[model samples]
Target: MSTTTAPEAAEAPAAPQLSHGLKQRHLSMIALGGVIGAGLFVGSGAGIAVAGPGIILAFVAAGLLVMLIMRMLGEMSAAHPASGSFSVHAEREIGPWAGLTTGWLYWVMIGVAVAVEATAAGAIMHSWVTGVPAFVWVGIFMAFFCATNLTAVKNFGEFEFWFAAIKITAIVAFLTLGVLGVTGVIGHAPGTANLTGRGGFLPHGGDGLITGLLPAVFAYGGLEAVTIAAAESDDPRRNVANAVRTAVWRIAIFYIGTMALAVTLVPWDDPDVVALGPYVTVLQLLNVPGAALAMKIVVLIALLSAMNANIYSASRMVYSLVTRGLGPRALAKVTGGVPRLSVLASCGFGFAAVLAGYIWPDTIFLWLLNSTGVAILVLWLFIGAAQLRMRRRVERENPDLLTVRMWAFPYLTWLAIAAVVALLALMTTSADNRAQLYAAGVLVTALGAVGLWHQRCTAATAATAQEPGRTP
Candidate 1:
């Protein structure tokens, strides 16, 4: 079916105009920094504990998956850039239901991520200044980012660019230090002792490697922020294409390289790997001065960067949904070429989530986190599915739009889908992951049903208006 005349596409009003304020440099930095979230700093301990040195393999696998998903997403976004990104593509290719399901799922995921990132940053700051409360810090950080997002799109882009530059510089420096330490330049090289020893690198065996993949995959969650931001860039196609091309090296150096170094410099099973995190553990081993304080600052910056980016992406996504009639029309309003109302709505939800952590940490907050746990995977599935269908349609109707083509077309697309499905099925075997999958399934199903109902109602209304009128 031609997207130009699809009923689902026609049901929504025309997209609202947004500022093309994001520059090529901003897009590049966002893509580079998006992959290096606080999760890499704090959460990788579990993967290292479980997979040992083989955590490298787990990260590589996850990184490859992200790279593939980004390529597919970039292809679509380059062809037809929109704030909705994959959600818009899904609605055009699959139907209104797919769009609504994926859009809201992604929006909710980022909203929760905003709260999580804010809380993590607050905890770190409170540790530095014991007199100040963590909640107060969270409020301060929240307000600061919110103010940045509420203004022109350029402010948001500028904030993310510098935030990303900090993280990129830190990781590159860390990697350089790690290579030097491993090469016997700075210190005696362990020489595969960490990898060969400690249960011969396999440690807990294949099951451990599989278990490690869970965290490793989740660490790549925010990479899609670049594509979402691409729509507002000065040159959407060129910027998205460049960003997607660089994703390979970014993931290679920032994630895979760092994991290799962490396991190489220090024992993967080191208690401090879990106690102080992989970065701090490796830095302390290398005798870097003030390693602990240094990593704390870097990790704090990471959390803040993620908080800022997720807020921008989530607001744009909700704004896109409203423009498509999937959400409240009021949120579709744009002031100064920025979706001010949608920005507030996104920030408000994140703030409410922070309060939920205080009021009902175990019940409400935990549920919010878990329910959105599998959202990234779900969105990946939607992207794959939409790309498979949209690719064929675009080729038939407008071959010129295939600037950033998916490698190997249907084959790689199918492979990604299968990999995701296999992982989702495997997740059901684990008790904790099973709960998350169940909650996510519930959320997707409810949204899908609502979307379908709305689609049918809109069709009926359009039909009635087209019928012959007795008054006329």
Candidate 2:
């Protein structure tokens, strides 16, 4: 393996490029499934609890924000395709400090996300077969995904393709059932009873709706995974463009549509909505046989699918960072077009998180989860900032590179940034959310300081080497 740093690594002959093993179909399915995760399947119940039928509004708001973010990311990514995605754009258009901060923060966020998904999946399985321990299930899941990601990149794509297909099919079927129940085709239509009877929609008022935004936003976190995968596809530019173009419908159908159906079919205050999850609650309300078992099977698939993709994304992210001379050179080594070392490192962190759960289930484990809870919001800020600068640079230096453009130029870009800032402020105001924002803040600040310091030192070293009297 080559042990070259950033500036030198660019010239290193041994530094291998990632393979274009992903196909358009893989990207298409990934784009569809990226937004539909355990977060939407399981976490949306909390949003409903807070916002009632108004949760639909919260999801729509969050969905629009994510759409804007995706547009900006697609603009930059299609212009300069790379496995690094926004990290590479950040470094070039912003600075090395920005790149390091964005890449490493995302790597940590996604790594923790892997643990989150595994834990959720394991708990679901353990519920079915109580004899097997939850942590044991987590370990099994972690090992399985680690092995999958360590092979050729196509294996990851194929896994995600099928995993996504299963979940998508399940969601479509659920929506179809919801439509039937709502129109009285299958069962008695509640006829707006569920939505209007329960405190008349905005039960908790505007504050509750604002509070609901936190989870609503978090559920949209994984949509960026498609853009990250774009670099490995045969046509990064076209694939990314197509994926972004379809994000609107995907978010509408999967997120906003589901929230609407969930709130319409079942009372928002139903305890089972929170306890049994919204999907199962709706199924049970409609008198579907084996509702719990059916949704549990679907939820398990969603969690496991998300876990696999998170590991793959985290590994590729860190691998991109290391290849640019940001971290350990050994991790940058790509064999068979896969960064196997980075895969292990990502899965290792996830397994460590599992142990943390066992050792300190209450304090330490909660902190670990909270720390990553808001990391996606921070990375979105980076994507928006990078796009703001890169759009102009590309237009001036290489006009044709603007294969996809951010809508409304600087205006919408500014709007996106301001919206993120507003969400962060809202997070600080909530007692439940305050801890998560603070934990994420501490980690991001630490990483930013280190990135800036490293950037300055690298600059000074380069200047010194260029001096006339310097030794060659």
Steric clash pairs (candidate 2)? 6-325
Q: What are the models' TM-scores?
A: 0.97, 0.96
TM value for model 1: 0.97
Per-residue lDDT tens digits for candidate 2, residues 1-472, read 1111353223123356778899999998888876688777777898999999999999889888888999999898888777778888778777777788889988878877777778888898898899999988998999998999988889999998998998888888889999998999988888899888868899999999998988888888887788889989999999999988986567667888888999999989989888888999998888989988887888888888889888988888888888776788898888888888988988998888878877888897888788788888888998988888778767888989898888899999999999999999988787868999888888888998998888888878877888999974
Residue lDDT tens for model 1, 302-387? 99998999999999999988888889999988888888899999999999999998899999888888889999999999999999
- How high is the lDDT of residue 36 in model 1? 80
lDDT of 2 at 232: 91
Off by over 4 Å in 2: 1-14
